[model samples]
Target: MASLAVSLGLRAADPLTNLVGIPNYAPAYLAFHFVWAYGILSSRTLKQWYKLDHQESPRYDLVKYGEAAVKSGKITKRQLNMMQRCESASANSVENYTFFLGAIGFATFSGVDRQTVNYWGLMYTAARIAYGAAYVLIEDRKVALVRGLLWWAGNAACFALLWAAGGKLNA
Candidate 1:
């Protein structure tokens, strides 16, 4: 009975898990999945921009090809810079996606509150989207700090979820 409860994260003593609303894991998992898919598709779309410019089989390497294009006057520096921002934003999203996925999964398995997990998952998704938009749109270096704040917000949520999971598992 104890093993089954642990495996299913169904500790009868944990009041938070018995919440009336948003107490399932599926919705949180879907939120994470949507962000991951968005990152991959965004990166691919940036690559397609390069393809449009090159027309005849551009190199797959974004950094090298972008630099070469800028040096060779094939593309303007501003264009390369914009592409770099988009690519970096996509890359950041993908990187964070890995950590968020594990954090939420472990938290769920450890019997952390499903409502809390859902809130973290949804908030993290929104933060990543805002981070990407800020990264691309904010030109002023000082004002661009908003992107860093958004990134930290998402990471903080993951850390909080992981911490909660750890505490619950130890108990």
Candidate 2:
């Protein structure tokens, strides 16, 4: 999507340039997807963990379990509450990120005319898949850090690409 957007934008500004090739900003878009995907996959793992810990129930009773765990001295109240809050936040983040991606995709399809932007969008999707897998399966501190850094770098690249593209459009 980002690639398409970039392509359209570039074409609008200068029609002679070929817009099908990958743009420099592709990495940045990839990073954004990486982080978002990681968040989503991790959240799923969290949900699974919650279910396993609480037994196979129709609904997650995290709040109830947390309270009970605290009352029974199995866990501190603060810890229980924090865990619940984290789970809730993770769920919300996954939904929000998915929506964001969908919006970008929609914009690209709606005649935004930027092929570079569309290409970036594809990169973002790939990065996001990797990011999610890493978040779910990797626990090593260094590995985790690298994944996070890559995700951020991708985002930074996207921002720079957007800024550069915007300049081109206006020029």
Instruction: Please give the distance, in angstroms, between residue 62's alpha carbon in candidate 1 and its true position after superposition.
Output: 4.3
- For candidate 1, the TM-score is 0.70
How do all models score by TM-score? 0.70, 0.44
Tens-digit lDDT track of model 2 for 1-171: 646666577533333344444344434553564465455433335445544264555136564465676677766755554455445444544654544454444434333345646555665455545554554455566777756755664455345445545555566
Backbone clashes under 3 angstroms, per model? 0, 31
Question: Which residue pairs show collisions in model 1?
Answer: none
Q: Look at candidate 2 and tell me the lDDT of residue 106.
A: 43
Alpha carbon lDDT of residue 159, candidate 2? 56
Report the Cα lDDT for candidate 2. 0.50
Compared to the true structure, candidate 2 yields what TM-score? Answer: 0.44
